[model samples]
Target: MSELRDTELSAKVKGIEVTVTFPLAHGKPFHAKQAPETTVGTVRSEAMSQFGIQEEANSTYYLTHGGSRVDDGATLASIAGESEAVKFTLVKELVQG
Candidate 1:
């Protein structure tokens, strides 16, 4: 008396390597494996967790690669392409009232 469900997809997601760097003293960059469809915000959250950074409502962060800003909504695959590892800098944005 068991029911069966179909779970199959034609397309598969690939894992991408990413490294995040922080500007704080003694801050070291860390590497993480993520799917190509993963968003920048997800990566930022991981970094924050790894670094033990407390989340602030008024403060914000930005991810940059090669001196270019990466949008939070952008996917890792779109930014890294076929590279072995994508380098990203986590910069804290100054909030103005």
Candidate 2:
């Protein structure tokens, strides 16, 4: 786990705010501001790096929003509705199960 930052991100990342939490990581959650068109896969990848989680052959990491598993291809705009921020939880499980 890493520290959750209250960032004043530059103009390059001014669209929507994103925060991601791990079920059992050490520190705080991952936080950033990203463009509305950013994909869930992108967020997941960055969050993984921030939390120092590695990919595993037997496991698959996924993102969930509002208790429902979110598709990697989905964009922030699709999930955010009329809001300017979004939150997600990161979880890992057996790939074949």
Candidate 3:
């Protein structure tokens, strides 16, 4: 059987949209059914790995889904209040290759 993953997801909290992205190996597709129920931090770590981001940069990521948006600096309470885990399509600068 093939492995499953949750590559992307979105949540709407307080009328805002929050998008999440997870990393998959180059040329290896995600198995949607097997993805974990992750949090905002999880998404960021995935992006960091995919982009070769060093820990010192402390870069912020932007998330968008439907009509809502969230930044990496957003508080967990804020995100939890407005979003839910749902399948989404991920598009990241580093994942382009």
Candidate 4:
């Protein structure tokens, strides 16, 4: 039952201030406070717990941004830039073995 600290984010969507909450797999929600420097892999790791996914589950997931797949080494800032909010979709990678 780990609790994530609440973070307030300010973003302007279409000239309106909006607050967005990012939901994790574990029912815990978080904001993109450190998203500018955070990598997709880091976010994925944090979300694994929410989905009851084990690190060694022999599965892989991808975080897609702006209709494109983000690389593990890419930072959120690189994808969203200074946008008020960014949408990320968690997709399970299909195993091809």
TM-score for all models, in order of appearance: 0.77, 0.82, 0.31, 0.59
TM-score of 4: 0.59
Q: Give the runs in model 3 whose Cα sits over 4 Å from its true position.
A: 1-36, 55-59, 71-97
Comparing 1 with 3 on TM-score, the higher-scoring candidate is 1
Best by TM-score: 2
Q: Give lDDT tens digits, candidate 2, residues 28-93.
A: 999998887778999999999999999999999999999999999887777775478999999998
Worst 10 residues of 4 by lDDT: 1-10
Predicted candidate 1 versus true structure: per-residue lDDT over 12-50, tens digit per residue? 335778899998726677789887767888998888788
lDDT of 4 by residue, 1-97 (tens): 0111111211222221112223444454433454455566877666555556665455567777655777878655555544645666666665656
lDDT of each: 0.74, 0.83, 0.39, 0.52
Ranked candidates (TM-score, high to low):
2, 1, 4, 3
For candidate 3, the TM-score is 0.31
For model 3, the local distance difference test gives 0.39
Q: Which ten residues in a row have the lowest lDDT in candidate 1?
A: 1-10
Q: Per-residue alpha-carbon lDDT of model 3 for 1-97, expressed as tens digits? A: 1112122222322222333444533443222221233444555555555555445433334444443654544444334432343333343433232
Residue 97 CA displacement from its true place in model 4, Å: 1.7
Question: Which stretches of candidate 2 lie above 4 Å from their native place?
Answer: 1-14
- Candidate 3: Cα lDDT at 58: 36
